[model samples]
Target: MIVRHDAGRRPGYPAAAAVFAVGMAGTTLPTPLYGLYRQELGFSELMVTVVFAVYAVGVITVLLLAGNYSDRVGRRPVLLTGLAFSAVSAVCFLAEGGLPLLFAGRLLSGFSAGLFSGAATAAVLELAPAERKTRAGFAAAAANMGGLGCGPLLAGILAQYAPRPLSLPFLVHLALLVVACVLVLLLPETVEDPERWPRLSPQGVVVPSEARAVFVPSALAAFAGFSLLGLFTAVAPAFVSGPLGVTNLAVSGAAVFSVFLGSTAGQSLTERLGARRALPCGCFVLVAGLAMVGASLAVELLPLLVAGAVCGGLGQGLAFRAALTSVAAAAPAEHRGGTISTFFVVAYTGISLPVVGVGALTVALGLRGAGLTFTACVAVVAACTGTYLLRRPLPERNRE
Candidate 1:
């Protein structure tokens, strides 16, 4: 086996993970406050999802075009640039006047996330101690989910109790980004060569022929899983306030947080049950959760909605982590990054496109009808995916 010389000696792993968490947190900070934007701006539900989709567009563009930039120019530089984008994104929100500003903020946030997904993850892994690889993986995953969970939580608390719901969260995020930048500067450079910057071009989805069999199922599972996340992040609050009659911003934020928190908890379960078991198991739970959500929409019950969020979030976490593990192990080392990028591209598509469909359906179907329709469709897809995985489980040798 190949060994890394500085594996156990590096001190930047924790710092990099912290920075990663902060940046990811910034991307979702506006989630709970979308309703306020709607109230002030007089925009439609379709516009909400359209704005969210724009962020995904920015992320996919960056992943395709500059995903490997850190591999050449060095992690610190790329991360700093990402942080800069984060700062600009915050400024966009802070200066928001109309739809254009909101769109700008979200797009910049997407750019920041695309950069973090590659450079920060690589930096965290590189800085980790060799024997602590498993722990590092957990750290990175937790930082991602935990940070995402914290965003709406923080924004909700601030929006409900603090002044300027639209303004405070971004301001707080800007401060955190500044701190993250300083920490990044202090971390030792992980990349060995800084002079070998290659001519950059879009490296769109690169799937090696050998990995196709497992990749299809993995990508499908990811797509289904991320759609659950998309639903909660994009419009769960609207569901909460509009149909369920819950008007507290903190409660709305908490609802969103619960899904992500459940996801984080589900990810930990992967270690116990293994990815093979976790992948299908997650889909089943997700389907059940969707069922609950559909019922809640029909009956207008907040408790059922909350219950669904927890259960579905857990399922998503479990399946998402398993999918990542399975795909990573199956991929050729040289092509791993691109393969994973493709997986995320599918996942992000799930997050964007389906939610936008929900937005479109809302015009004719109304919120309850739109919600019921959304849940039914996603549940069916998840059920089908789960059944397929159960029927053709990954080979025993490949599972961890």
Candidate 2:
């Protein structure tokens, strides 16, 4: 196998990062538009979470079955296919008139995200100079969250001010996907002499025993952090419109965008703090953010809610990036893709399962009350993780 080591050749990392961001951006373009869908389809709040969870379902399924495919098949082919999934998802949303299309679109988006999570990340890292690996990690994390952040921001701006809120965003996304496809085609393949493609089958969770200790705490932190994201992506808009009386789609989109922006900021902190210190510190911040969220729910305050989203998002970003970088660094090159996929499996589970719980609780507690309950639960989990990390921090090398 002849892996490219001449990072100086053309520095294709930027192009890879751009493709990563574009693919990821499409998955989240629907975040701020869920409310409009609810209105058009006349679905209950519970159904909204259900629609969102369906996407998570698709992501988790792909991670389990095909998460490591790129490791064997080469990065370019998997990325092209993932981009295709994203474009099809955009088309689904563009043609959406009811719940079925919503679910289908979300599922396809989830698949795209699952494929991107491991492949795009590996590609970006591989394309970077060894000396620039840290920077590459930042770029990858930023593209993931930054792309996600831009999604709502783009959709909200277009939806609030432009015509055909639903149709326009997807159309824009489809165009971006086309651009991403072109970029992928132009980039060199990272994996050299990859194994021949085999019949597809589930690549069940496989964590090396040596890495389990590090993986457990890292995965826990991710789970807690992602739960906050789930709350925002899946439910916060309803909270904004229903209780806070913010009907503007742009405002709601901005609110979601704030958390992701905070996350991007938080990821930048990881290099300075080291992954170990960053993890606990992030957990503490996450707890505080969740507290603010609960307070906002109680008092029905918009600023407090936004503050919570930002703080919690920053915290989530910090811990999540640290967790991902540390875990990816620890894995053997041969197993890197599968290990990263496993980490995402745990993280996405946090995003899906807890949000579904919140949705179910909404049936009885209403949105605000259920949101409060979620905030409390996640805060407690984060606090415990933080406390544990503080006492028994990962080794300094692992922390790197």
Candidate 3:
């Protein structure tokens, strides 16, 4: 187990960020490959959504049950366990023969991500030197978006150019998972107590009383932002390959990557705007992105689709980070993990539920029609949230 010293210079923050990046990248490795699975497995769009929802269920379960495990047992143990789940997930994919295996693979992948989300973020922040806290936040956010973006791009390239398209990508990711596990071993642990291990029990979702007002708006913004991310991650590849006449896995992955790239760019601007202003602005930007996405579907324009990805991703990044920062600032230190987990539970629901609805809609309507429908719904939600945030003022100090 890696042990972090409270006094001595911490291990390199960027290094910790890199570890986080690789872990997150592994979580999204399946994004670009969904089309391949659909074709090979002969599953419908609805089935794909079901598979995706299964992953979300796994994520929610872990977050609800083990969200604060890292805090009690230390970051390294939880992170290592998460990576182990990733390894198992890759193995499931590699051995996949039917729908059950696919479900298992996604479920394991979700479990891995659920554990990593909180543990890795906390680890990255704590590993940073005292003066670089802000940079540390950026590092954490970048690693998340950058790594998620990289997953599809890497898988797409390997699956397109490399032999054994479906099998090879998972195998390559398994190797990367091994490397990440070793890196986690080398990293210093941030939690102070090693001996005081608590028996595992569910940590009920906790939100600070003071943060309640900010929580509603902030969580709503998060729901909208994550809903956008869910679209690309869960369904965009099928849309690209089906209606847009883009079949190459690499190209499909690049489309997904564009959104995440936009998110990273959007996050960089958060420092200049402050959290309150950024939250509403992000919602507006997301609506604009959704509009572009709708236009792309109407015209079958690939460039427009790419533009939508970037815009939507940027909007998600801006709103999500601001929401997280605000919620963290408002939450009491003692219940921080539970509060953050609760936040993510809501965010993941956004990621899972709306996309599932789109999948169901795709079964009746065609992909384009479903795309337009999703765009309209999300646009309405984002517009309303943006208006609410803009009309109200932020509390000067957290009530709690």
TM-score of each model, in listed order: 0.95, 0.94, 0.95
Identify the runs in model 1 with alpha carbons over 4 angstroms from their true place: 1-11, 196-198
**Candidate 1, after superposition: displacement of residue 252 in Å?**
0.9
TM-score of the candidate numbered 1?
0.95
Angstrom error of the Cα, residue 174, model 1: value is: 0.7
Residue-wise lDDT of candidate 1 within 291-362, one digit each (tens)?
Answer: 998898999999999999999988899889888888888889989888888888998999899999999999
Deviation (Å) of 20 in candidate 3? 1.1
How far in Å is the alpha carbon of 106 misplaced in model 1?
0.8
Compute the lDDT of residue 360 as modeled in candidate 1. Answer: 98
Local distance difference test, per candidate? 0.88, 0.88, 0.85
Candidate 2 per-residue lDDT over residues 1-400, each given as its tens digit: 4566464555388899999999998878898898898888888888888888988989999999997788778899999989999988888888875888889999999999999988899899999888889788889989989898888889989999999998999898888888899999888888878877765767678788877877888999999999999888888888999888888989888998889989999999887988978999999999999999999989999999999999999899889988987887788877776788789889999998999899899999999889999999999999998999889888677767
Candidate 3: Cα lDDT at 103: 92
Off by over 4 Å in 3: 1-11, 398-400
lDDT for 388 (candidate 2): 90
The model with the greater TM-score, 1 or 3, is 1
